[model samples]
Target: MRSPAPEREGDDTLVWNVACPTRPSSVPGVAMAGFSDRGRLPEGQRLIPHPAVTLVLDFGPAPPVVDAADGRRHRGSLVAGLGLGGALWARGDDLACVQVRLSPVTAGAALGVRPDELEGAVVPLDALWGRDAARIGERLGEAASWEERFALTDALLARRCAAATPANAVDPEVNRAWDRLVASRGRARVERLADEVGWSRKRLWSRFRAQVGMGPKRAAKLVRFDHAAHRLAAGHDTARVAAEGGYTDQSHLHRDVVAFTGVTPTGVARASFLTVDETAWPTLPLGGVNAGKTV
Candidate 1:
């Protein structure tokens, strides 16, 4: 049987209110979700903690080449972006209006993609799955209408999962290093990490590519930068943020802030709700809480 799910929209962003379909009864989870946003080159692209399974409803215009796990650029068909809960690094004027967002575990299981492979990995939207562009459009067109999208989403997810491949796991060393950086809010050294992991720089880089989807140094920078952003959002001074996040100085932090988010710390804090989705943007409340559920 089908159910009615609430829908919400915004200037460049829209989120549908829905319950997580497959989450544990006691453990909070997110069911299938839908989102549509017009892409604008926002400051730095950020990463999310959990992975996602997404479907591109339609690419309004031209396609964009996003960074991939292998660091290779893959050209996609959709004038849209679809990302699973993986690491993404973006620094360009790529734009699109996209749809579909799913919880990490549900998405991974439904799509047959592993959770760890998505950690810190970024691939062109199309690289992960090659679907008939027209078919994808058809699904989106139907799903966007009324609440039927949920059922359509279910079928679509099932199909994708049926044809999907098993995802690989992230490297232990690379993951450990990433965890430390994230826990420290972006403070650590590759040399020290390498010594702890007992892997050479070359080996570490390779592992990062395979597991985390980025090089160690780049990932570290992102971790530190992400921490800086959270600090700024939470009302930290620019200089203090720089010092705490391990930047050489406030100027460096400022540059990174501009380079990554296209806004100053104060600017980020000033806004009530953020617009551009920082690919790896950190959220407050320590862990994370699932919001909005209907009785």
Candidate 2:
């Protein structure tokens, strides 16, 4: 049974319209989703910025295109490292893709590469995986159905995860720190996190940035902003959202929202991207009302 989940649409083109489930339990810090966008639109998509690194595997006629804020162009099945306040413009025809979100914790293992190498950049998957990336593409392209593709992806990730040791693969302390930030809804202080992780402030700062793609302070701020953005989308008042989201005041909250999304808090309240997230990633806090449903 296939379903339609429209990510965005217009008179000419469509992507992400087929509704489906992204089982989060398949891999740590990784979620699976698929989108089919065909037809030529003058523009394609503006990636909704999230804290997670996105690995997109495209099996369309031509690879998807990504124009980053810093004037970099990327194409094909690509891995986007952790981002800070930027949108990737995706444009082209036949933009079918399967995307996986990798938590900084699982990046080293799942990617067989390091997040630091890709931070603030988008690179073809082959760049990291060499021949394996091509093999995966061939397998995905030959799969008869989306379900099969999803299963293959799951198996690959599970195998990698099994091989990756928590301590040896990446800094376990950094993983714990990230968990704390997520648990606290991004409100946890880096200094406090350092104390808990048994690292000095400077060591934590350097190592966290090296592995996670951004310094701890910046990552925390981005996490906090994601939380606030969701609250605003859920129809909370700006002032209340601000206070609850850990801003000094409404003005502080306003600045952060604008900086992150290029929109005011009120503007974010009307974002459809967040609305789509409810069904796409149920475990995400933005996924409140639509949690645990597969269409």
Candidate 3:
């Protein structure tokens, strides 16, 4: 029931261990509620990639802005931010939950949905499961551990795959652009992307909006930020994160961190067990922060 905090007093980083609920105990391996403290993620100069499947539930009075580019808002007490080709942060909740990180293409194919079109939709997690919210809620309320919750999540994903249709397949162009953006992060310009994809800016924009729910530039930025965030979380210094991510300087990194998650670099890097994905390393510059910290 408690949310994760950014950091505790006397320390810079905070990690909350969330319990998985298990009363109706059917789904398995997923927590009923999880949240993270509204801490800032470090700034990086590079573009990041999105996690494959992210389930977000906001225990708030209103639907928060899930993505600035799509302008999609969610009012339901519980919503899912499933990323086919993007990253998302809850500017509202200090949260924690079991998120099954998968490859976008693999997850999409397995779910029978085009990874592109699912970019910014905040559909109910249970809706995707074809089960009533309370039914799933009961399962979560009874779940015992993170592993159990993950198992339940895998089952739910399987069910979703069975129910999917061709209508769910996203546009191929969207995937093409998404792949390029992921590969380049924020380093690639829109004009260059347009040329590579053989589409006018207008054409790309239309396709992007329809398939990915945002322009290529915004999506690229979010993806890039995710990569930088991973680096910061992994103990990379600020300057290094910025430079590697393609930022002009530490200020640029700071601005991006504040703009995306409303948190600062030092705040996120406080955690001692942060893990960095190597592919995302370029987003952070080397030897950027705490180079002088006394060992």
Candidate 4:
């Protein structure tokens, strides 16, 4: 899949060769995509935040570098938490990597860490996975094709899930609440979610935050923003998108678009990060359990 060439001056014209696995992963809630740059990578490519944990395994000749709004720089393989609010920029050349998106419901088990620990943060994979991180990078670099890389990644994630301890398990109630929120596209009420889960509002909020890395309300907003951003990218008018996307008014939608992405709705409509989805991940569910499910 090819993204439109970036508009910035002096940036390379990037053409990405995107590949998807021939079959679904054995592990649920895990999705992967492979991207190889046909030319030098675009400079300072902004990344729009989504509502799922992201893991990038870089095995290109040169490692990619990500710069955060806070002025921190991360290189090579890394994991980014949900809801970063469009504060990250990726810059590199000769990029080749398999990107994985993990649903919050299963991220803890697959990552061997509480999702909450990663909120709004990007960490080097080796920091969490130790020597195994380096080993996987080496193996991925040695793989002969994208298909082999996908298979290797799926096997690694499955092993991690299988080895997760009880402590990494998410509560069934939390899972249910997440499902409802996704199904509603973040239009679901928190009080109603609490009641449905048979828990008080306070209890539900605490548990969801602890297990999912953010409060229920924040998660809902992120999910809602994700939906609206895509519609805008599809060329829908802002007023119509606001009306049907659970916003009280066009202004409300504008605020959200700016809040989550640090850009106006118009700007977001043109974002390469979002526009690329049409081809790179045409069939993926954005924020659900099986999100990022490529062809």
Candidate 5:
């Protein structure tokens, strides 16, 4: 069967949709996207947040200039850390990129940088993977087709992961905490997680923060908010989604949406950047990982 193509191209964005990658099982949590801006991109920024860490590679005439809330404008292929209520303002001309999402546990190994090191930051891939990042960018840009690019990326990550040492591994307890958070759809209690892991709350907080980049509570909140946002996009009513997502009320949901994306729930539901998730990342279910497995 043929892979899917972009649904539509507008004056601002040109997206080339491809089939999900079928590669080594070592990296089931990975997903890929290929897209470009049609000639000229419109003004304004987009707030992008997901359960997994984001890696982007630029190959078009103009690479994306993604300005995060901290006022840092990062260019070229880069890794976007887990955003905790962070908004990224992006703008460029003739922009194209292949965006990858790796389960946070595997992300650190493939990028050779711990997740905590990327908290609240958007960094150039060169800063993390150095020469390897440069080589990957060149190879991806030179690939003849979308399928080839996706395959190349998957193989590269899988190889890197296989060769990584124990230093790159996450703490088993911390890894479990993350899995529970995702499985619970961010509803897992931090205290319960601490007990489950046989650690005190403070210890759990310190370790998880150092490994996952965000404290357990914040990670849960981010995961829960992501679920609610996608549900809103799926055309659910605001009140129903809020209640189902465990929000105290519609107002609480509104506050979170505003906090995370700097926009109303309705605006989040209409976000094209988010609307593409289903098509571009078919295998990436909610929680963004296989809970039972580590990395």
Candidate 6:
């Protein structure tokens, strides 16, 4: 199904046509959203850092462009690692693409590289997948409808997963730690995770960083920030969100919001990135309890 996405570029409200897949992906830990804009795309659309790895397949009349905080500009299809640190802005016109959010546990297998390699960086898809990236983009452009595009993307991911070697598999203990963090909405303690996973704190931290692209504490914080940000976007007061999100106080929440998003709580509430979640991610599929469920 397709609908107009609610978006805001600062004070100016903008809309982009958003499309969702008819069915969930056959691959576990994967969710997809398709976006198209025949008119001019919104400028300065800040990308909020989420806990999942993001893969964007651009196949519109013109490729999309992402400007980073360091004055680096990335064009065309790209994959961003988990915890982007809130410094990326997307700008383009006539944009069309399928954006996939992958659980870090599954990202290594699907991307043919450890998630750590992509940490906090946006790399062109071609850099990782070589010519295969261009071929997939071409197929997406040639697809007759959004459903076809979704199917094509899903199949590609499934193929990649199937071809993954033993070297790419995530350690089961690391997966358990991630699941616990998600289940607790990022309130899980790193020491407790290490205990539950039967590993020393130091060991768990190292494995998680190597496999999931971030340490346990940082990952948990990102997950917590994601939950709080969504609640703020839903119009909840900062005090209430802070209490429910396990913050020590309103000030603690404010610091975290600023640290991750470069914005205050009110600013995050008005952010187009968070506002569009309802239309773009109805399943809310970012590594919940059923993260690795397959079709």
The candidate that achieves the highest TM-score relative to the unseen native structure: 6
lDDT at position 158, candidate 6:
93
Q: Per-residue lDDT of 94-181 in model 2, one digit per residue for the tens? A: 7677777667667777887777877657777898878888788788889888877888888988897788765326677888888787
TM-score, every prediction? 0.50, 0.83, 0.56, 0.91, 0.88, 0.93
RMSD of 6: 2.6
In the range 1-295, model 5's lDDT, one tens digit per residue, is 1355454645233233434555423574566666655444457447557777888877766678877777777788888887622867777777767777776766777777777888758888888777877788788789887768777877888898888877778888988898898888888877899999999999999988887778888888888898998899778999999999989999999998888888899988776566666666665574243342632
lDDT of each: 0.45, 0.71, 0.47, 0.80, 0.74, 0.83
**Candidate 1: tens digits of C-alpha lDDT, residues 1-295:** 2222333455332121122233222211223333332344354243322222343344324444445434554343321111222333332333332334443333443434543455434434444555555566555555545245555555666565556554533345765665555456546777677777888878876765554445557556655665566566666788888886789998888776665445666665543223223321122212221121210
For candidate 4, write residues 1-295 as lDDT tens digits.
Answer: 2333354666343356677777767887777788877665556577788888888999999888898756789999988887652558887889888988787888889999878998768889999999999899999999998889999999999999999999888898898888787778889987799999999999999999999899999989988988898888788999999999999999999998888878899988877666566555544655322432221
lDDT of 4: 0.80
Clash number by candidate, in order: 19, 7, 51, 0, 0, 0
TM-score of 2: 0.83
How much does candidate 6 score in TM-score? 0.93
Model 3 lDDT tens row, 1-295: 3223334587633333333323322321112323323333232112123433344433323333344224554433333333323223333333334433333433443344443546545455545444454464456447775446546656765576556576654456655676676657556776777777788889988876554456777766666676677678776888999999988899988887666545577755542323322221111222111000110
Residue clash pairs of candidate 5: none
lDDT of 3: 0.47
Candidate 5: residue 27 lDDT (0-100):
73
Off by over 4 Å in 5: 1-19, 23-25, 38-40, 286-295
Stretches of model 2 off by over 4 angstroms after superposition:
1-15, 19-25, 38-41, 162-168, 266-271, 287-295
Report the Cα lDDT for residue 173, model 4: 89
Top candidate by lDDT: 6
Model 2 C-alpha lDDT versus the unseen true structure: 0.71
Please state the error at residue 79 of candidate 1 in Å: 9.5
